[model samples]
Target: MRNSRIPFVKYLIELLIVAFGVFLGIMISTYQNNNRTEKNIKKSIGFIHRELKSNSQKLDKAIAYHYKLKSSFDSIKKELPSDLAMENYYTQQAFRHNKVPHWTGLGMASMDNIAFESAKISGIFQEMDIEEVQAISRAYSYFDSYTKFSENLMEKLLAIDSNSKVADIIVIFEVLGSDIIITEQRVKEEIDKINSQLENINK
Candidate 1:
């Protein structure tokens, strides 16, 4: 009696096809995972770039404000006594002096605002060369100088009375204002440089 069932070779061939199909499925799954990982990395980079751009603009504005105040304070200092004399200038003098535009807040946002932001950004892009780190450091250095100047100015303000405090305040403001201006300028440069580097990487 002959075997009427399907041929043994046909059964083996069907089994081989199923195995090949499974292997193909696995390859496809791995390819998709790799693609998804690449997409995630790109998205993260895009987010970082946007944040840097926003921070750069803020830093620019801050720099402008600092310099504007510095220039006005410079004028005010010139108009006031050249030396620290016991004269109640700003208070009693009823001097219709134009308030320094930048001094409206008279609050220091120096390091926390820009330098720290830069540093944080630098951390985000560790793949960058040491030059980027140095650029960030330069920006931070400017901010540090500005903050130190601010601290010393506050000390000077406390050092004197109403009679002498006015001149001291003027000096402090002038120095701080200048430092702020320098910070703004330096940060701007660094931001541009870092952003350029980042752009190259993304591109």
Candidate 2:
């Protein structure tokens, strides 16, 4: 009977050992996966930060251009009726040749979204805080809306009859100038806020 009992004890020990080994393996796997996820989160954040930096620079130029355009429009609008009369051929011709392009369609630079796209596609956004995700989403939404507005404005300007009255053209220019002024300030603030958030994360 003692010999039989000895065999049963040995079997129990083997079963316990196998269970322990499986548990250890599971723990290691979980730890490795968590570490990899942490690294991915950090990498994704860094990528976003770099992309934002490039976007911020683009916005800087855009803001400056818009401001310049606004200034030009304001100056031209003041002289509108007098200039439209075309009493002096040379002066009228000079203004037409020099300022026509400024009043026409100006191209807007597209914002970069490589990192944002990648993060969304690869599930990196899942690792980010809900608030961070919302903030980034909101920023890009504004960018998209602004871009669409610009495109629509260009289309409307282009669609205008070449023989349209100077007063009508001036109205469009004034409207565009107003939009640019508002949009430029909003973009500046958004970029500055995003940059600040990035700096905080780095810290």
Candidate 3:
């Protein structure tokens, strides 16, 4: 038979105290972690929504240019022997007068959206919103098509030769006008979706 220095009652009490301490510490740590995660998610959503706003404005400007070109095309169709003046007007209208894309704003916007999405996905996964996703994903494609239309329009303008055909002018009006409408609709839908998600996050 072996005898311990401590009493059995005292040993049992000490073990219980240690287990309680460990459990309390765990509860505190877990609560803190949950709070921090919630804050981060909210922050991400806010940042991304701001980015989406800026990007939408830039795209909207492009859409305005498209509308202007369509108008120019309409009025000029009355005249014949399309010349330098008319072509130049159309080119300037089409390229937005050489207005460049807002890269800095766009970069910030992309980063914000990505961060927001990451934080969001980490928590309860919202059902995949692929419809809006598809529209949003098409931004670059819209730009690419419109850019080509712009360049080609510019070329036709430069080569006016004072004897341009009606067909040449009509081509630009057809392509650019149509593309702008599609892109504008897509951008609006994407903006609405982003706004809705951000509101949910904030609430």
Each prediction's TM-score against the native? 0.58, 0.81, 0.56
Q: Show pairs that collide, candidate 2.
A: none
For candidate 2, write residues 90-112 as lDDT tens digits. Answer: 33442452364354346465778
In the range 1-203, model 1's lDDT, one tens digit per residue, is 14645577678889999999999999999999778665654554555556556666767776667677777766766665445334465565623223554476444444444434543555543544477456545544655665685576567655655456454556567655765567556766776676676577667
Alpha-carbon deviation at 142 in model 3, angstroms: 9.4
Lowest summed lDDT window (length 10), candidate 2: 89-98
Candidate 1 has which clashing residue pairs, if any? none
Query: How does each model score on lDDT?
Result: 0.59, 0.71, 0.53
**Which candidate would rank higher by lDDT, 1 or 2?**
2
Give the Cα RMSD of candidate 1. Answer: 6.5
Number of backbone collisions per candidate: 0, 0, 0
Q: Which residues of candidate 3, in runs, are more than 4 Å off?
A: 1-6, 78-173
Off by over 4 Å in 2: 82-107
